[model samples]
Target: MTSNTILQNATETTISGDAQVINAGRDVNMVHGPPAGLSQLLRPVSNATYTRSGPVAKCDPGTRVEVINMIRNWLNRRDKQSVCWLNGPAGYGKSALSQTIAERYANKGRLLGSFFFLRGAGDRSHIARLIPTLAHQISISVPVTKRLIGRALEEDCTMLDSSASIVHQFQRLIANPLSSPLNLFSFFAKSKILVIDGLDECDDKVQMAEFIEMLIDMSQRDQLPCRIFLTSRVEEHIRKKFGDARAQSVLYCIDLAAFDARPDIQLYFEQEFGHIYDQNLPIMRRIPQPWPSSQALSVLLDKAGSSFMFAATLVRLVGEDSMPSKVLQEVLDSGSNGLDPLYKQVLSSASPTPAFHRVIGTIMILLTNQSIESLSLLLDIQAGEIVFELLKVQSIVKIPGDDNKPIMLYHTSLRDFLTTKS
Candidate 1:
């Protein structure tokens, strides 16, 4: 047996293109086919590009060049470290960077799977779906693993049950299947990658820790077939888990807060504002050639203060409003400091009501995603009334035009702000 794979059954399946190997079982008619079987048991982020939604925001063109290159180099390297951690404070653009990396690698066929955790997004916000989701994606990416995983599930039957342990779920759904000699030989030839973003958003701290421990254990044993890229805020539970010397050996950590993003933020503002100016050209004509005066840009940039969330929120406010210039002026005149002050200003501008408070508060704390209809029924408020209140805070809340889609915060910081002691 080679270090990468067991060669005993290497002759069973021949190497072939995706139609034959990577995308196996799609054409098969069986209701209990491996692909169909796995799909039934997993819940993935439906909005990912691979699914129904469009591509997510990547690094803006010509931005984050250094960090992007660093990760690319790490991926290209032949080394023992199988895990990379990109940790930073909120608003440092960790998710953007992770999305960029995932898309880039997935295009090249080196991506095994990616999971992006989003708070209040139902299964995406918790640990229960993590392994099953990854296993499903893995089965698609490596068809041999799909058959093996299906077999494991059929044999155990309870691997995905709510009462099953994370360890049991991992072993049955991921570890045992990939441990097969056939998988080790073919799929383990080169390094594949798994990208997981927003680990802190997962509501269960104990499960999150256990998941990381499993990764560390696999990395230490040279068992992971692909490298894992993870991103999250430096929360205490997460920080302490990665702080250990043993964990550090198999995992390389990057603190994004340590890097200055002024250059990138400035570039983003220039490009986004340029688009805004072009779209509102008739109205923009009244303003100067550069649109926002350099002084105004300077003031807004200062307020941004290493926070992309602030910059992004302000851009949406200006671009979406009837009078972009007027909104810009209001943002400039606002006296609040940091995100809290800006949040307060936004809330104040909305003329928040008791109903609005109930709605927004419920959004911040909901364990799962909810639509306006569900919320109205749960809170005993009229759906139209809820919609009217949400319209006022459109800058921060994402209310889908489709009533079926869940309303979500534009940034997790909004929830953090609303929940924190004043």
Candidate 2:
């Protein structure tokens, strides 16, 4: 049973003297359980854009080594600049870099918590659960944190209530426990990292601003033990909010776009292109190893426009199509126009079947994910048929481990490509 279910039934058992007989294990868990409101706020890790402990197969390698080094420099120093923003556009490798850092510190025991705020991935989209989730994680990770956090919640259980302000929740749920003398593990020799990625994805402008303010307040004080590392697009809301003296005092900013992506981008094309050649050689013998000629690769690099998404999108398209040269030629001729035509080419090349067209269109416009069975049911088609259609575009759409998991987009640009009227 869920912690909430067990607690609810336990409450009823006291009044009615009978509910379903409670399990001992569940009862024990409930004693340490967060309030029902906080429990409901838990977004499954699968909802995060990057699920694994590290970067996945198609993800470009770690070219942001300097960015990671900069973060370390900040962490090692006694400076009060607790918050660092790795700001960049949609297609830059900010999320990937964030994932790498979280995994690195977490394994070393210096990671207090990691929260990835994905766009359109349910509760993962907002700051509602941010503090509570961090609280629960840190409390469990560092044993002494339990007394500090547990006492706070026990004293004021309404802290997690919907009416509670964001600052209030952070002050109690995050700031209180962190500021205390945490029980030390041998691995925790340094300040821990609290990684919050994709801040721009959270739609609540007001709550977001309040959360930043709270971070600024904590940075000035000796309380909170961990340094905050956040990644987001430089949205105007964040720009205006962080413009304050307090925000500026504690904030360290890094622009991912400022770095050279060419070397990394080149490595990405060479590797993925080689993978496609090896995998699809039997289907089409014409494509050669190191498939795109050196000249053509140069052409691609010039037009990639310093965006990893540009490279990623084209690679996905090439993976799906047997004729990589045709796609390469199209890309070469498209000139400096950017990703518009390449997207159009992919969409226009959709299967002639109406079902396939419908599936692609729906996936493009649908902000969030749905299961294969759910999509089939929603589209009034068989599950097998939906899978078949999705397989045709395996490069762009990511199928989950099972039918129960939602189908996710490989990149958000596909949505922009399909939804816009170009």
Candidate 3:
């Protein structure tokens, strides 16, 4: 399916109000109720879902069509080449494409679950929540697997303990349940898949290694019966893991950077500039209809460098408290490395202090993630004071939507600048 079709009709699955189906069973070993804290351990992490076209944003029209079709075709096919990976560097829109495809299949009732990883966002950024989250969703969607999964959890509550191996948890809590008599024969025959994006952003290197190895073994051996659509940067660790010569035959791969990004990016510039002209008619009353000059468009496109995040950051810079013409002029004057100047603009506008520096440093360098409250404890400050400092640089740092959410860098480049641009 085209990306346009996916965006218009797709909806993500949520567990907020899903009714728990509890039934008594024949086997004495199988317990009915989940163990006291097992459900929490298995609970899906918050803010893991990415909306296709809501507040979070979606792919612009005419973007990622080819990639979308390629993935859909693979998902529809039934074969032992069971894993399709869309790999690329940061800012190339891998996560956006993943969300669009997820919405498409989810609207068609084929998506088992999707996990989006944000670096330094705690559980959302690790393999810790991967198995339980997938198991919970599949049980809810497939229903029959629920009883089997409950029994597995009841048998040994330590299945999800930190000390237990990733392979062990996945085998008992996830693979075994789905492959049980409940749904084995039909699984390989079906056209469904699980969507996992941002694998490289996951923090635990050892766990990630075991996670990928176990997944490869299961698919090749037919131990588990679902297809996986995964996206990540070709980080050295991930690249090495997938490079195992024996598994190469079963892994399908795509590198997004090699494709021509000019056409889609050009269209995005046109639409956004037109919106700016309409929205600020009073300030832009005399601006031309296709507001930006061709010369300016050429310059901006040159700096976009085929990276979607670069294009997006430039658009925001133009629209924010500055005239389009003046911003475009500044952009044209900047050298090939235009993002550096733009980064400086954002930092100067924020007017940082020592405390703000400390808060932002923690946000950028965190090993996993922590919410504002937890950060306060770690930083030895009042909880309310954290957001107060974060507000100064809200443009670059995303304050969470709730009390439970962690602060995050809006783009990977922001982290890049903070850590290396001394």
Candidate 1 stretches greater than 4 Å from native: 1-36, 42-56, 184-190, 335-337
- Residues 362-403, candidate 3, lDDT per residue (tens digit)? 877877657898888888977777888877665556677664
Instruction: List where candidate 2 sits over 4 angstroms from the true fold.
Output: 1-62, 182-190, 282-290, 364-367, 420-422
TM-score of 1: 0.86
As for candidate 2, its clashing pairs are: none
- Model 2 poorest ten-residue lDDT run: 13-22
Best by lDDT: 1
Candidate 1 lDDT score relative to the true structure: 0.78
Candidate 3 local Cα displacement, residue 117, angstroms: 1.7
Q: Write the per-residue lDDT of candidate 2 for residues 1-422, one digit (tens) a residue.
A: 33333453445334242223324544533333333332344332433433443224323455656777898898787677878888898778777778788777788878877788866666777677777777767766676776777677656757777678888877776666666555544234237888888888886778898787777777777455668889888888887766786677778888888888788889888888888778877754666545788988888888786777778878888877767667767778875645666666665666658898888777766766677877888899988888887777666678676776677776666676677777
Model 3 lDDT, residue 226, Cα: 73
Q: C-alpha displacement of 178 in model 3, angstroms?
A: 2.4
The CA lDDT of each predicted structure is 0.78, 0.71, 0.73
TM-score for each candidate, following the candidate numbering? 0.86, 0.82, 0.83
Candidate 1's residue-wise lDDT over 1-422, tens digit each? 11122234346654333222222133321122233446775655555323335224568888888889889887887776888999988878888898888888888988877888888777778888888888888888878888788788767767777777887787677766666776864456336788889999999898898888888888888776678899999888888788878897788888887787888888899899999999998888888868577888888888888787788888887888878888888888976546777777678888889999899889888777789989989999998899999999888888877667788787888988988787
